[model samples]
Target: MRFVWRWRRNPLRRRSDVVEAWAGVAAVVLMLVLGTAAGWAVGSFAHGALREAVRQQQQHRHLVSAEVVRSVTGTPAEPDHESTTGREGYGRFLARWQDPDGVEHTGLVALHQAPGPADRFPLWTDDEGRIAGRPMDRATAVVHAVLAGAAAAAGAAGLVEGVRRVVVWRLVHRRYAQWDREWQQAGHTWGRADAGS
Candidate 1:
Protein backbone atom coordinates (compact mmCIF):
# COMPACT_ATOMS: atom_id res chain seq x y z
CA MET A 1 0.00 0.00 0.00
CA ARG A 2 3.02 2.24 0.49
CA PHE A 3 4.22 4.18 -2.58
CA VAL A 4 7.20 5.90 -0.92
CA TRP A 5 9.73 3.46 -2.37
CA ARG A 6 8.28 3.89 -5.87
CA TRP A 7 8.89 7.63 -5.67
CA ARG A 8 12.45 7.27 -4.29
CA ARG A 9 15.56 6.56 -6.38
CA ASN A 10 15.72 2.84 -5.51
CA PRO A 11 17.57 0.42 -7.81
CA LEU A 12 15.03 -2.31 -7.18
CA ARG A 13 12.05 -0.17 -8.27
CA ARG A 14 10.72 -0.90 -11.76
CA ARG A 15 9.00 1.68 -13.96
CA SER A 16 5.77 -0.27 -13.55
CA ASP A 17 5.89 0.33 -9.78
CA VAL A 18 5.74 4.11 -10.28
CA VAL A 19 2.90 3.72 -12.76
CA GLU A 20 0.91 1.59 -10.31
CA ALA A 21 1.38 4.17 -7.57
CA TRP A 22 0.09 6.96 -9.82
CA ALA A 23 -2.78 4.76 -10.95
CA GLY A 24 -3.91 4.25 -7.38
CA VAL A 25 -3.93 7.97 -6.72
CA ALA A 26 -5.93 8.65 -9.90
CA ALA A 27 -8.42 5.90 -9.05
CA VAL A 28 -9.09 7.32 -5.62
CA VAL A 29 -9.66 10.79 -7.01
CA LEU A 30 -11.94 9.49 -9.76
CA MET A 31 -14.01 7.40 -7.36
CA LEU A 32 -14.75 10.38 -5.16
CA VAL A 33 -15.46 12.85 -7.94
CA LEU A 34 -17.50 10.51 -10.17
CA GLY A 35 -19.51 9.07 -7.31
CA THR A 36 -20.59 12.46 -6.00
CA ALA A 37 -21.44 13.85 -9.41
CA ALA A 38 -23.42 10.81 -10.50
CA GLY A 39 -25.34 10.68 -7.25
CA TRP A 40 -26.28 14.33 -7.38
CA ALA A 41 -27.31 14.25 -11.03
CA VAL A 42 -29.45 11.13 -10.67
CA GLY A 43 -31.08 12.38 -7.47
CA SER A 44 -31.98 15.72 -8.97
CA PHE A 45 -33.37 14.17 -12.13
CA ALA A 46 -35.44 11.62 -10.21
CA HIS A 47 -36.81 14.24 -7.86
CA GLY A 48 -37.92 16.46 -10.71
CA ALA A 49 -39.55 13.63 -12.65
CA LEU A 50 -41.36 12.29 -9.61
CA ARG A 51 -42.63 15.71 -8.70
CA GLU A 52 -43.97 16.20 -12.21
CA ALA A 53 -45.72 12.85 -12.13
CA VAL A 54 -47.29 13.76 -8.82
CA ARG A 55 -48.57 16.99 -10.26
CA GLN A 56 -50.03 15.29 -13.33
CA GLN A 57 -51.73 12.61 -11.28
CA GLN A 58 -53.22 15.16 -8.94
CA GLN A 59 -54.52 17.13 -11.86
CA HIS A 60 -56.07 14.19 -13.73
CA ARG A 61 -57.17 11.87 -10.93
CA HIS A 62 -60.29 12.38 -8.86
CA LEU A 63 -61.54 11.02 -5.55
CA VAL A 64 -65.17 9.90 -5.45
CA SER A 65 -67.44 8.19 -2.99
CA ALA A 66 -68.00 4.53 -3.91
CA GLU A 67 -71.08 2.71 -2.61
CA VAL A 68 -70.71 -0.98 -1.81
CA VAL A 69 -73.32 -3.19 -3.48
CA ARG A 70 -72.29 -6.51 -1.98
CA SER A 71 -69.30 -8.28 -0.44
CA VAL A 72 -67.62 -11.29 -2.00
CA THR A 73 -65.08 -13.85 -0.87
CA GLY A 74 -61.69 -13.20 -2.38
CA THR A 75 -60.53 -15.76 -4.93
CA PRO A 76 -57.10 -17.43 -4.75
CA ALA A 77 -55.83 -15.30 -7.57
CA GLU A 78 -57.01 -12.19 -5.78
CA PRO A 79 -56.48 -13.00 -2.14
CA ASP A 80 -56.97 -10.13 0.25
CA HIS A 81 -53.88 -8.95 2.08
CA GLU A 82 -52.70 -6.12 4.18
CA SER A 83 -51.81 -2.93 2.33
CA THR A 84 -48.45 -1.19 2.60
CA THR A 85 -49.86 1.09 5.32
CA GLY A 86 -50.62 -2.05 7.41
CA ARG A 87 -54.36 -1.85 6.90
CA GLU A 88 -55.90 -5.29 6.58
CA GLY A 89 -58.02 -5.99 3.53
CA TYR A 90 -61.07 -7.36 5.34
CA GLY A 91 -62.99 -8.05 2.17
CA ARG A 92 -63.80 -6.88 -1.33
CA PHE A 93 -67.10 -5.48 -2.59
CA LEU A 94 -68.76 -4.67 -5.86
CA ALA A 95 -68.88 -0.90 -5.68
CA ARG A 96 -70.24 1.87 -7.87
CA TRP A 97 -68.96 5.38 -8.30
CA GLN A 98 -69.49 8.35 -10.57
CA ASP A 99 -66.57 10.26 -12.00
CA PRO A 100 -66.34 14.04 -12.16
CA ASP A 101 -67.69 13.87 -15.71
CA GLY A 102 -70.87 12.17 -14.38
CA VAL A 103 -69.87 8.79 -15.79
CA GLU A 104 -70.76 5.81 -13.61
CA HIS A 105 -68.49 2.81 -13.10
CA THR A 106 -68.55 -0.35 -11.06
CA GLY A 107 -65.67 -2.57 -9.94
CA LEU A 108 -64.34 -4.69 -7.10
CA VAL A 109 -62.99 -2.53 -4.35
CA ALA A 110 -61.08 -3.63 -1.27
CA LEU A 111 -62.17 -2.39 2.14
CA HIS A 112 -60.26 -2.27 5.40
CA GLN A 113 -63.32 -3.59 7.24
CA ALA A 114 -66.41 -5.57 6.39
CA PRO A 115 -68.81 -3.28 4.58
CA GLY A 116 -72.57 -3.41 4.79
CA PRO A 117 -74.70 -2.95 1.72
CA ALA A 118 -74.89 0.70 0.69
CA ASP A 119 -71.85 1.64 2.77
CA ARG A 120 -69.70 4.30 1.10
CA PHE A 121 -65.97 4.88 0.97
CA PRO A 122 -63.66 7.20 -0.91
CA LEU A 123 -62.07 5.85 -4.08
CA TRP A 124 -59.67 7.32 -6.57
CA THR A 125 -60.49 7.27 -10.26
CA ASP A 126 -59.22 8.54 -13.56
CA ASP A 127 -61.04 10.71 -16.09
CA GLU A 128 -62.95 7.77 -17.54
CA GLY A 129 -64.16 6.58 -14.09
CA ARG A 130 -61.80 3.59 -13.94
CA ILE A 131 -60.33 2.79 -10.55
CA ALA A 132 -56.85 4.08 -9.80
CA GLY A 133 -54.31 3.84 -7.05
CA ARG A 134 -53.57 6.80 -4.84
CA PRO A 135 -51.12 9.32 -6.16
CA MET A 136 -47.58 9.42 -4.71
CA ASP A 137 -47.16 12.03 -2.05
CA ARG A 138 -44.30 14.54 -2.20
CA ALA A 139 -42.58 13.09 0.86
CA THR A 140 -42.63 9.54 -0.55
CA ALA A 141 -41.35 10.78 -3.89
CA VAL A 142 -38.43 12.55 -2.21
CA VAL A 143 -37.47 9.43 -0.26
CA HIS A 144 -37.53 7.32 -3.42
CA ALA A 145 -35.32 9.84 -5.20
CA VAL A 146 -32.80 9.77 -2.36
CA LEU A 147 -32.61 5.98 -2.39
CA ALA A 148 -32.13 5.93 -6.17
CA GLY A 149 -29.36 8.50 -5.90
CA ALA A 150 -27.54 6.49 -3.25
CA ALA A 151 -27.69 3.34 -5.41
CA ALA A 152 -26.30 5.23 -8.41
CA ALA A 153 -23.46 6.63 -6.32
CA ALA A 154 -22.52 3.16 -5.05
CA GLY A 155 -22.70 1.75 -8.56
CA ALA A 156 -20.40 4.44 -9.91
CA ALA A 157 -17.88 3.86 -7.14
CA GLY A 158 -17.93 0.12 -7.67
CA LEU A 159 -17.30 0.51 -11.41
CA VAL A 160 -14.29 2.77 -10.78
CA GLU A 161 -12.83 0.31 -8.28
CA GLY A 162 -13.29 -2.58 -10.71
CA VAL A 163 -11.45 -0.71 -13.46
CA ARG A 164 -8.60 0.12 -11.10
CA ARG A 165 -8.28 -3.53 -10.03
CA VAL A 166 -8.20 -4.69 -13.67
CA VAL A 167 -5.48 -2.20 -14.58
CA VAL A 168 -3.36 -3.20 -11.60
CA TRP A 169 -3.81 -6.88 -12.42
CA ARG A 170 -2.60 -6.38 -15.99
CA LEU A 171 0.38 -4.34 -14.79
CA VAL A 172 1.32 -7.07 -12.31
CA HIS A 173 1.11 -9.71 -15.03
CA ARG A 174 3.28 -7.67 -17.38
CA ARG A 175 5.86 -7.17 -14.64
CA TYR A 176 5.91 -10.92 -13.95
CA ALA A 177 6.42 -11.65 -17.63
CA GLN A 178 9.34 -9.23 -17.75
CA TRP A 179 10.85 -10.93 -14.71
CA ASP A 180 10.42 -14.34 -16.38
CA ARG A 181 12.33 -13.16 -19.43
CA GLU A 182 15.16 -11.79 -17.28
CA TRP A 183 15.27 -15.02 -15.30
CA GLN A 184 15.58 -17.04 -18.50
CA GLN A 185 18.62 -14.99 -19.57
CA ALA A 186 20.15 -15.34 -16.12
CA GLY A 187 19.57 -19.11 -16.16
CA HIS A 188 21.60 -19.45 -19.39
CA THR A 189 24.68 -18.01 -17.63
CA TRP A 190 24.15 -19.75 -14.31
CA GLY A 191 27.20 -21.43 -12.69
CA ARG A 192 29.55 -19.86 -15.29
CA ALA A 193 32.80 -18.41 -13.97
CA ASP A 194 31.89 -14.94 -15.35
CA ALA A 195 28.30 -15.02 -14.00
CA GLY A 196 29.01 -12.93 -10.86
CA SER A 197 32.06 -11.09 -12.24
Candidate 2:
Protein backbone atom coordinates (compact mmCIF):
# COMPACT_ATOMS: atom_id res chain seq x y z
CA MET A 1 0.00 0.00 0.00
CA ARG A 2 1.08 3.60 -0.59
CA PHE A 3 2.59 5.42 2.45
CA VAL A 4 0.00 8.20 2.16
CA TRP A 5 -2.89 5.74 2.43
CA ARG A 6 -3.71 7.12 5.84
CA TRP A 7 -4.49 10.51 4.27
CA ARG A 8 -6.55 8.93 1.50
CA ARG A 9 -10.31 8.38 1.74
CA ASN A 10 -9.97 4.69 2.50
CA PRO A 11 -12.60 2.89 4.55
CA LEU A 12 -10.04 0.40 5.88
CA ARG A 13 -7.73 3.00 7.39
CA ARG A 14 -7.96 3.41 11.17
CA ARG A 15 -7.80 6.58 13.29
CA SER A 16 -4.78 5.19 15.19
CA ASP A 17 -2.83 4.98 11.92
CA VAL A 18 -3.40 8.69 11.20
CA VAL A 19 -2.30 9.64 14.69
CA GLU A 20 0.87 7.60 14.23
CA ALA A 21 1.68 9.43 11.00
CA TRP A 22 1.28 12.81 12.72
CA ALA A 23 3.52 11.60 15.53
CA GLY A 24 6.20 10.65 12.99
CA VAL A 25 6.12 14.18 11.60
CA ALA A 26 6.38 15.63 15.08
CA ALA A 27 9.41 13.47 15.80
CA VAL A 28 11.24 14.80 12.76
CA VAL A 29 10.42 18.39 13.72
CA LEU A 30 11.70 17.81 17.25
CA MET A 31 14.94 16.25 16.01
CA LEU A 32 15.60 19.19 13.75
CA VAL A 33 14.46 22.19 15.79
CA LEU A 34 14.36 21.34 19.49
CA GLY A 35 17.28 18.92 19.46
CA THR A 36 19.59 21.19 17.50
CA ALA A 37 18.68 24.22 19.58
CA ALA A 38 19.25 22.35 22.82
CA GLY A 39 22.67 21.16 21.63
CA TRP A 40 23.78 24.63 20.59
CA ALA A 41 22.69 26.20 23.85
CA VAL A 42 24.41 23.57 25.97
CA GLY A 43 27.58 23.90 23.92
CA SER A 44 27.65 27.65 24.39
CA PHE A 45 27.15 27.33 28.12
CA ALA A 46 29.90 24.74 28.41
CA HIS A 47 32.33 26.92 26.48
CA GLY A 48 31.71 29.86 28.79
CA ALA A 49 32.01 27.76 31.95
CA LEU A 50 35.24 26.08 30.82
CA ARG A 51 36.80 29.34 29.71
CA GLU A 52 35.98 30.89 33.06
CA ALA A 53 37.59 28.00 34.86
CA VAL A 54 40.69 28.45 32.76
CA ARG A 55 40.84 32.12 33.70
CA GLN A 56 40.37 31.39 37.40
CA GLN A 57 43.07 28.73 37.35
CA GLN A 58 45.45 31.19 35.76
CA GLN A 59 44.72 33.66 38.55
CA HIS A 60 45.05 31.18 41.45
CA ARG A 61 48.22 29.45 40.24
CA HIS A 62 51.77 30.80 40.32
CA LEU A 63 54.97 29.70 38.68
CA VAL A 64 58.09 29.00 40.71
CA SER A 65 61.59 27.99 39.66
CA ALA A 66 62.93 24.78 41.15
CA GLU A 67 66.14 22.71 40.98
CA VAL A 68 66.29 18.98 40.43
CA VAL A 69 67.17 17.39 43.80
CA ARG A 70 67.89 14.01 42.10
CA SER A 71 67.81 12.67 38.55
CA VAL A 72 64.85 10.59 37.35
CA THR A 73 66.64 7.50 36.05
CA GLY A 74 63.62 5.37 35.08
CA THR A 75 61.95 5.80 31.69
CA PRO A 76 59.03 8.24 31.63
CA ALA A 77 55.53 7.48 30.35
CA GLU A 78 54.85 7.95 26.62
CA PRO A 79 53.67 11.48 25.92
CA ASP A 80 50.58 11.74 23.78
CA HIS A 81 49.88 14.48 21.23
CA GLU A 82 48.19 16.61 23.90
CA SER A 83 51.27 16.93 26.07
CA THR A 84 52.63 20.43 26.68
CA THR A 85 54.78 21.99 23.94
CA GLY A 86 58.38 20.71 23.59
CA ARG A 87 57.50 17.69 25.73
CA GLU A 88 57.15 15.47 22.70
CA GLY A 89 57.79 11.91 23.83
CA TYR A 90 59.07 10.78 27.24
CA GLY A 91 60.55 12.88 30.08
CA ARG A 92 59.80 13.56 33.76
CA PHE A 93 62.05 14.16 36.78
CA LEU A 94 61.93 14.72 40.50
CA ALA A 95 62.44 18.39 41.31
CA ARG A 96 62.42 20.60 44.42
CA TRP A 97 61.38 24.20 44.79
CA GLN A 98 60.62 26.82 47.45
CA ASP A 99 57.38 28.81 47.38
CA PRO A 100 57.08 32.55 47.88
CA ASP A 101 57.22 31.95 51.65
CA GLY A 102 60.49 29.99 51.28
CA VAL A 103 58.78 26.71 52.04
CA GLU A 104 60.51 23.74 50.33
CA HIS A 105 58.72 20.99 48.38
CA THR A 106 59.57 18.13 46.03
CA GLY A 107 57.56 16.09 43.47
CA LEU A 108 57.63 14.52 40.01
CA VAL A 109 57.49 17.03 37.18
CA ALA A 110 57.36 16.71 33.38
CA LEU A 111 60.11 18.35 31.40
CA HIS A 112 61.15 18.51 27.76
CA GLN A 113 64.49 16.88 28.63
CA ALA A 114 66.08 15.10 31.57
CA PRO A 115 67.12 17.53 34.29
CA GLY A 116 70.50 17.35 35.98
CA PRO A 117 70.66 17.64 39.79
CA ALA A 118 71.88 21.19 39.51
CA ASP A 119 69.47 22.15 36.69
CA ARG A 120 66.74 24.62 37.50
CA PHE A 121 63.14 24.13 36.20
CA PRO A 122 60.04 26.29 36.36
CA LEU A 123 56.84 24.67 37.68
CA TRP A 124 53.34 25.80 38.57
CA THR A 125 51.68 25.53 41.97
CA ASP A 126 48.13 26.04 43.19
CA ASP A 127 47.09 28.23 46.11
CA GLU A 128 47.87 25.42 48.55
CA GLY A 129 51.44 25.18 47.17
CA ARG A 130 50.82 21.77 45.49
CA ILE A 131 52.35 21.06 42.09
CA ALA A 132 50.00 21.67 39.16
CA GLY A 133 50.04 21.52 35.38
CA ARG A 134 49.45 24.43 33.10
CA PRO A 135 45.92 25.79 32.97
CA MET A 136 43.55 24.98 30.11
CA ASP A 137 44.35 27.11 27.12
CA ARG A 138 41.61 28.59 24.93
CA ALA A 139 41.82 25.96 22.22
CA THR A 140 41.59 23.03 24.64
CA ALA A 141 38.67 24.62 26.46
CA VAL A 142 36.73 25.06 23.21
CA VAL A 143 37.36 21.46 22.23
CA HIS A 144 36.04 20.17 25.54
CA ALA A 145 32.93 22.35 25.23
CA VAL A 146 32.21 21.15 21.73
CA LEU A 147 32.51 17.51 22.81
CA ALA A 148 30.10 17.98 25.70
CA GLY A 149 27.55 19.69 23.43
CA ALA A 150 27.67 16.88 20.90
CA ALA A 151 27.07 14.30 23.64
CA ALA A 152 24.03 16.17 24.95
CA ALA A 153 22.57 16.56 21.46
CA ALA A 154 22.89 12.87 20.71
CA GLY A 155 21.11 12.01 23.96
CA ALA A 156 18.17 14.31 23.18
CA ALA A 157 17.74 12.95 19.63
CA GLY A 158 17.97 9.36 20.85
CA LEU A 159 15.21 9.98 23.37
CA VAL A 160 12.89 11.42 20.72
CA GLU A 161 13.53 8.51 18.35
CA GLY A 162 12.83 6.00 21.09
CA VAL A 163 9.45 7.56 21.85
CA ARG A 164 8.53 7.60 18.17
CA ARG A 165 9.38 3.93 17.84
CA VAL A 166 7.19 2.96 20.76
CA VAL A 167 4.17 4.87 19.42
CA VAL A 168 4.55 3.31 15.95
CA TRP A 169 4.90 -0.15 17.44
CA ARG A 170 1.67 0.23 19.37
CA LEU A 171 -0.15 1.41 16.24
CA VAL A 172 1.08 -1.63 14.32
CA HIS A 173 -0.18 -3.93 17.06
CA ARG A 174 -3.60 -2.32 16.93
CA ARG A 175 -3.70 -2.76 13.16
CA TYR A 176 -2.91 -6.46 13.49
CA ALA A 177 -5.57 -6.87 16.16
CA GLN A 178 -8.18 -5.29 13.89
CA TRP A 179 -7.24 -7.60 11.04
CA ASP A 180 -7.49 -10.63 13.33
CA ARG A 181 -11.02 -9.70 14.34
CA GLU A 182 -12.08 -9.19 10.73
CA TRP A 183 -10.59 -12.51 9.75
CA GLN A 184 -12.45 -14.33 12.54
CA GLN A 185 -15.79 -12.80 11.53
CA ALA A 186 -15.35 -13.97 7.93
CA GLY A 187 -13.90 -17.37 8.71
CA HIS A 188 -16.97 -19.12 10.24
CA THR A 189 -18.74 -19.65 6.85
CA TRP A 190 -15.57 -20.55 4.92
CA GLY A 191 -16.85 -23.97 3.78
CA ARG A 192 -20.44 -22.88 2.94
CA ALA A 193 -21.19 -22.76 -0.77
CA ASP A 194 -23.18 -19.49 -0.46
CA ALA A 195 -20.54 -17.68 1.63
CA GLY A 196 -19.23 -15.67 -1.33
CA SER A 197 -22.75 -14.31 -2.09
Best by TM-score: 1
Compared with the true structure, what per-residue lDDT tens digits does model 1 show for residues 1-197?
36787888889988999988898889889989999999999999999999999998888888899999998774332343222222365576788999998988887777777879998899888788877778788999999899889988899999999998998999999999999999999999988998893
| Residue 83, model 2, lDDT | 31
TM-score of every prediction relative to native: 0.84, 0.77
TM-score of 2: 0.77
The alpha-carbon deviation from the true structure for residue 29 of candidate 1, after best TM-score superposition, in angstroms, is 1.0
- Cα error, residue 39 of model 2, in Å, equals 1.4
lDDT digits (tens) for residues 1-197 of candidate 2: 55588778788778987898798889999988867887899999999999999999888777899888775656654354223534466466777887767888886666777767879977888776677777778899999999888987887888999999999998889888988998898889777898983
Model 1 alpha-carbon drift over 4 Å, by segment:
1-5, 74-90
Error of 2 at 141 (Å): 2.1
